[model samples]
Target: EPEVTQTPSHQVTQMGQEVILRCVPISNHLYFYWYRQILGQKVEFLVSFYNNEISEKSEIFDDQFSVERPDGSNFTLKIRSTKLEDSAMYFCASSEALETQYFGPGTRLLVL
Candidate 1:
């Protein structure tokens, strides 16, 4: 399957600001997910969406974060308020089922 892809490979923002990360998951995949890896920490799952609704999400995905499928091919992750800790590499992924996922190159966000 073709891998997922994210736009604006890098982003720089100020604390308390908002950022919307865009993604295009594999066309045929039914499940899409967002994850982030801090500079030195393990990759952490943020949220997963299917059939236009969120199927699951981690605690880290609080009110500050949201996911949406605005169209047939575009999926988006919006961070309502940025924080220094929000700096990380955000990855978009897609899977045929709940199994193996194909990850994108990632968008590196730097909150200053």
Candidate 2:
């Protein structure tokens, strides 16, 4: 079974900056999602995309956050202005059905 993969396994950034995290989900999956875990907190859902549009998103996914499927294999999440609280391990997940999602290793974003 293919798994989702993310780039730049670790990232360090200054506050109020912009960051774009990348992911390559399993080829056959149709739904994609983004989730984040602050240093010691539980995983929190950010957004979900399907068919090139956002299907569902959490309140945490405010105006500063965006998701894109720029190509067939690449899915991206962009944070327009990073806040100190935005420092977290961002995960990418994909699923053929809504029930089970396979997660990537995650991109660790550190904001100063």
Candidate 3:
């Protein structure tokens, strides 16, 4: 069975610092996405990447954020500058199609 994996399960950084979170999805999957949940808040979509290009992005994915697929197996999310409000649990997900998405455990980010 294939599953998504994330690194640095928890991170703490000062405001204004840059952060890069890493994820590796199931090998045969075609679609990738990033989502975030602010503690008690609901999950919100950040961006979706497919075929080496961004297929869709939300307003939350502003200039401050970026996504990349460094190699055939790894995907990354970079936050150029972190803000206190950016503290949240970030999730990486993948799916063969838009109907079902398999999510990673998540990386908890805390900005102080």
CA-lDDT, candidates in order: 0.96, 0.96, 0.97
Give a tens-digit lDDT track for model 2, residues 37-72: 988899999999999999999999999999999999
Q: Estimate each model's TM-score.
A: 0.97, 0.98, 0.98
lDDT of 1 by residue, 18-105 (tens): 9999999999999999999999899999999999999999999999999999999999999999999999999999998999999999
List where candidate 1 sits over 4 angstroms from the true fold. none
Q: Any runs in candidate 2 off by more than 4 Å, and if so which?
A: none
- Model 2, position 101: C-alpha lDDT score: 96
lDDT of 3 by residue, 1-112 (tens): 7899998899999999999999999899999999999999999999999999999999999999999999999999999999999999999999998779999999999999
The collision pairs in model 1 are: none
Candidate 1 positional error at 94, Å: 0.4
lDDT of model 1 at residue 16? 99
Ranked by lDDT from best down, the candidates are 3, 2, 1
- Model 3 clash pairs? none
Model 3 residue 17 lDDT score: 98
